[model samples]
Target chain A: MRGVVLHGPGDVRVEDRADPRIVQPTDAIIRVTAACVCGSDLWPYRGVDKSDEPAPMGHEYVGVVEQVGDQVKTIKAGDFVVGSFFASDNTCEICQAGYQSRCVHAELIGAIGTQAQYARIPLADGTLVATPGPPDAGLVPSLLTASDVLGTGWFGAVAAEAGPGKTVAVVGDGAVGLLGVLAARQLGAERIVVFSRHADRQELATEFGATDILTERGDQGVTQLKELTGGLGAHSVIEAVGTQQSMMQAIRSTRPGGHVGYVGVAHGVALPGEELFFSGVHLHGGPAPVRRFLPELIGLIWDRTIDPGKVFDLELPLEEAAEGYRAMDERRAIKTLLRP
Target chain B: MRGVVLHGPGDVRVEDRADPRIVQPTDAIIRVTAACVCGSDLWPYRGVDKSDEPAPMGHEYVGVVEQVGDQVKTIKAGDFVVGSFFASDNTCEICQAGYQSRCVHAELIGAIGTQAQYARIPLADGTLVATPGPPDAGLVPSLLTASDVLGTGWFGAVAAEAGPGKTVAVVGDGAVGLLGVLAARQLGAERIVVFSRHADRQELATEFGATDILTERGDQGVTQLKELTGGLGAHSVIEAVGTQQSMMQAIRSTRPGGHVGYVGVAHGVALPGEELFFSGVHLHGGPAPVRRFLPELIGLIWDRTIDPGKVFDLELPLEEAAEGYRAMDERRAIKTLLRP
Candidate 1:
């Protein structure tokens, strides 16, 4: 089987690998129908995160189950499904509390590596949510999004308490941040603000119901947000970029007693406790428990209530995986979908 | 009028001062019935927070309104009231949102120096909540507690989301921390764990309904809490000390998706964003908006539903304010109440 592998920094390649098989009773083998390069993948590609040996790449996927182990009861062969980046045993106490990312026996599906022809997923019954049927070709990218980004954006909005009469500000213009604007609108936020400097992304943000677009960054961005919010700052701030500057902007843009839902994976940042304390804002975010919102997101995708698939501006065949990674890394594509 | 003044570290003295008069249309003059030294006072007393000159000390007080400006409508002369350490116009967006500490026009009473016999309170109509009537002498301490410590502890419990079926861990054994235990119990927490090493404070914590008392500090304290909570950590953790160790312990002791309500004034602590992001916990705290809880807390005190006054282990006349400060500094008393 052929799969995406990274030999070193900026060294993505499609290489032949041994086919995956169900090795545990709780595992299921899925034939990857669609996969994508995530924003997080740039860390290693840009040499920010070092890798010693060749590593498997993708985590987001929508696929058809090709095989199942003896203990997998809910998922079966030939079933169409969408699974989260992390595999969680839904029966665990943490998962039952709606925090699947912290499940007692959770496993990172990317380590198993979903950017391949066939992949074995652990805790199949809990990790994979079966779709109604084989989705149309047009519905592929949106369902693939539910596997991670869309579900994460929805969770971020919910965590920030973005709902009716609330003004929400999103701190990043990546695919996840764009989807956050959509989620905030769908959640009934009265005003949506997206911080974007790019003309193309700004148009998409407007289409997602963003009422305001600020071209500024950092402190200036906060100042603009306050100016638009009657000088009190937004009721909710979504932090989709995990950097010191972005985090500070998100925190500062939120009004006192307001919520900041941050889903960005923090690379290397430290928050001063004194500033956070004096800010008097509620802070709640982490590795989003995407599993908690997958069911609803899948429904929305099926009913055509949202079209998050617009984020996939570039597509490539599995054999041309390297180009897909290059395009996303160069900002030539918002998201790149790969057809297996 | 006489007031407590700190000439420098270890230089607390009661000195004659000019009587306070309403300085603003929204101000009210109060004759302080009771004032106390707070844990925060030790900051400047120990010279951690420098003061260039002899500064007035004390922020917690319960008093009788002696005069009111034309704009003061809700309160009047002769009314007994308990006010927060910070004055806030309750109708502001931030105050209405329950973060009066961050109110746009908030005034720090202590910074303005409130230990004087006669103190001027700004935003009087919004900051002071009057009791039903003149209360029995025994209610003085409890009402004074409500002015700051008890209200702060209650806010911590509410911010941490302590409630029925949840396990709560309190990370400081000071007056506010002990009161947090009482607040957790009143809020219906099933299991309350308090980390305390002092024998007297531990006993008081137990009396306040701490089902488990861990004498360990830092990581060990978190381990003890987790051991008692079936290895999953507490559902709610209240951080009453603003040090890095206490903050880390509070964060580590809370389960994923749990809440940490920290009300301790952060001295010099930095929170690593990566760890917090992976912890998947909700964090909220600050100088508590005590005014928001004043009415209910007053009712609880008047009806004897709670007895937070037990926190004051020593009492002295206004003339001996120096001894009151010394007693608290020497750890001979949890709290000291000075009567005028």
Candidate 2:
């Protein structure tokens, strides 16, 4: 099987790798149908997140189960399934509480490398969410997003409590941010504001139900959001960018008693306790429990209720994953999809 | 009129002050019947919170309305009332959203010195809550607590989502933390754990319905809490200490999907963004919107359902406010009530 691997900073390669096998009775081998590069993947590529050795790439995917371990009763061969970046036993106390990402027994799916022809998923019964049947070919990209970004955006909306009459502001113009705007709209938000400097991303944001778009960042962006919301700031803020500036902007752009849902992969960010304490806002986020929303999101995608696949602009064969990384790193594509 | 003034660190003097008079049409002058030294006062007295000029002390009080400006419609002469430290108009959008402390026209009652014989409360109609009648003489202390600590504790419980079957843990054992135990109990928490080193404070916490008392501090304290909750941590954590250690403990002691209500006046704490982001815990707090919970809390006090006054272990005449401050600063007294 050909898989993506990172050798060093600004270095990625797609090379032939040994095929994965079911190592545990709770494991299932899946034939990768589609995978994608994530914004988080850029962290290591940019030399921001430290990496000690060569590591596998990609955590998001939707594929068909090719083989199941003897004890894997819920999932079987030929079943199309989507799994989150964090593989969790959905029946654990943590998962039952809707925090599968923090499950007591959890593993990063990226560690197993899904950007390959085959991948091994552990705890199959809890990690995989099967569709009613084989999904339409057109739904592949959307279903793949449900494995991570789309599900993550949905978590952001829920964490921010975006609902009827809420003025929600989204910070970041990535796939997750645009999808957050879409999620807020689907959740009944009355007004959605997205901050974007790029025309292409701004257009997608507007189409995804952003009522207002501002071409500003940081303090100026917060000022614009506050001014637009009658000087009180938005009722809910979604932070998709992991930078300190984006995090602070999200907090400052929310009204007192409002909520800030931050889903960015934080790096080198230290929140001053005084400001957060005086902000009088609720904060909740992390690696989202994408497994929790997979079923609903997959249903929505199958029914054509949402077009999450719009986030994927550039596509290439699985072997061209190196080019996919370069395209996203060079800003030529908002996101890149790979077909196995 | 007379008031307590902080001449310098640990230097408090009861001095004669000019009488307060209504300067705004929305103001009301109140003759204080009971006032108390707060845990927050120790900040300045201990020099942790710097003060250059002599500043008036005390913001917690229940008093009788002595006079009202022309526009002060709801409160009048002789009406017994309680007002939070933060005065708000309650009619603003922020107030309507239940964040009266952040109201557009909010003012701190401490600015006018509620510990004085007379206080001019701004936005009287919105800031002061009248009792059913004159509160029973024995209810004065409890009513005063409602002006700050008790109300703050209630906000902590509410914000932490303390309710049936939830395990609630309190991080501080001060007047506010002790009252947080009571608030959690009142809010239907199944179990309440309080971290305390002092026997007297522990007794008060248990009397306030603490189901478990742990003397360990920091990591050990968090470990005990996690061990008690089947290694999953509590569902609701009340962080009433603003120190970094306590804040981190509160966050660490809460299970994934749990909530943290922090009302401690944060001093020099800086929360690492990475830890918070990965904690998977919801954080909400600030100077609590005590004004929002005043009516309901006052009602409970009036009905004898709660005895928050039990927290005031030392009572002194207004002239000995210096001694009162000394008692709290030295930890000789849990709380001290000053009569004016």
Candidate 3:
């Protein structure tokens, strides 16, 4: 089987590898139907996250179960499914509390590589959500998103307490942020504001239910957001970029007693404690409990309530995974979907 | 009238001043029965928060209403009442959401000097909670505490979601943290842990229902808390110290999905964005919405269901307030009660 591998910075390849087989009773072998390059994947590829060894790529996937181990009961062979970046034994105490990413016996599915023709998924019963049926070919990209990006965006909105009468503001215009606009809209937010500078991204944001768009960053962006919300700031602010500037802007964009739901993978960022304390905003985020929202996300995509796949601007065959990575790295595509 | 005033660091005076009277249509005149030197007062007294000009001191008070304005209906003359540090209109959208401290028309009553013999309380109807009658002499101190410390502690417990078999940890051993133990107990927590090094405070903490007392500070304190909670950390952690170390300790002492309710008036603290993001803890706090809890707290104290006055270890006449401030600043007293 062929799978994507990163040898070094700027070096990606689709190489032949051993076909995956269930090595544990709790594992199942899945035939990958769709996969995508993630913004997080860029961290390693750009050498920002130093790594010397060859690393397996991809953590997002929509696949069909080809074989199941003896212990797999809920998921069966030939079932269409969507699973998260991290595999959790959904029965654990942490998973029960809806923080499956931190489940006691969790495993990063990215370690095993989902961008392959065949891959072994551990804790199959807990990680995979079976669909009503094989989804229409047109829905593949959206279903694939439920595995990570869309689920992450959904988690951000929920964490921010976005719902009826809420003025929700979104930071970052990436795939996740754009989808956050959609999530906030679906949650019945009275108004949705998105921050972005690119015309392309802004268009996608507006299409995703944004009621207002600001092409500003940092303090100016916060000022514009405050101006839009009658100077009280938004009732809920979604932060999808993990930088000091983005984080501060997100906090400043929220009103007192409001919520800042941040899904950005923070890097080298330090928040002024005094400011955050005085801001009076509730802060909640992290490696998003994407698994917690996968089921609902899957249902929405199946019923066509949302088309999160609009985030994908380029599509490629599995063999051209390198081009997919390049396009995303150069900002030529918001996201690239790869078919195996 | 006479009130406690700060001349400078290490300089305090009980000075004569004009008596207060109804100044606004919603104002009420109260004869202060009990006023106390607050930990925050020490900020300006010790020059930690410097001010050159003389400023009236104290914010917590329980007193008898001597007169009411035409608009004051819920509170009448001759009523005994407990009110918070801030006076809130309690009818704005922010107040309706229970963050009365951030009400659009909120005013910090400290500016009027609750430590004075006579105080003109504005927005009396919304800022004050009437007791069933004049509280017994013994309940005076506890009811006075309800005006600030006890109410603040209660807010911390509620924000931490400490209830029903959950393990609650408190970071700080001051009057607020000590009372937080009582709040956790009242909230039905199975275990209450308080961080304290002072033998006297440790004793007070135990009496207030702290099941564990950690003498260590900083990283060691976090380790001890996790060790006591089966290595998963406490389910709810309250931060009563506003410093960066205390905030981080509170966050680290809680489990992945746990809540950290911080009430410390954060000064010069900066939280590492990366660490906080990955911690997966929900953070909520600022100035405690003490006004929101006044009525309930007043009820608990009036019925003798809880005793919060034990936090004050020293008492002095309003004329000797300088001595009270010195005692608290020198660590000879956990809290000081000033009589008028």
- Clash totals, every prediction: 0, 0, 2
The residue-by-residue lDDT of candidate 1 on A146-237, one tens digit each, is 99989888888998999999999999999999999999999999999999999989999999889999999999999998999889999999
Span of 10 residues, lowest total lDDT, candidate 2 chain A: A264-273
Top DockQ model: 1
Off by over 4 Å in 1: none
> Which runs in model 3 stand beyond 4 Å of their true positions?
B21-23, B67-73
Sort by DockQ, best first: what order? 1, 2, 3
Candidate 1, residue B147: lDDT: 85
lDDT of 3 by residue, B1-340 (tens): 9998888998999899889978898999999999999888888888989786898888999899999999988999899998878898888888888888888788888788888898988899989999998778999999999988988889889889999989999999999899989999999999999999899999999998999998888889999988898778898999998887899899999888899999888878888888898789999988888988988888888788999999999999999998899999999999999999
- Cα lDDT, all candidates: 0.92, 0.93, 0.91
DockQ of each: 0.91, 0.89, 0.79
Per-residue lDDT of candidate 3, residues A207-273 (tens digit): 9899998989999999999888777789999999898899999999998899999998997788887
* Candidate 1 chain B: 10-residue stretch with minimal lDDT: B109-118
10 residues in a row with least lDDT, candidate 2 chain B: B108-117
For every model in order, the TM-score on chain A comes to: 0.99, 0.99, 0.98
Question: Tens digit of lDDT per residue, candidate 2, span A113-139?
Answer: 998899999899989999999988999
Docking class of 1: high
Clashing residue pairs found in predicted model 3: A273-B269, A273-B270
Position B97, candidate 3: lDDT: 82
Q: What global local distance difference test value does model 3 have?
A: 0.91
> Compared with the real two-chain complex, what DockQ does model 3 have?
0.79
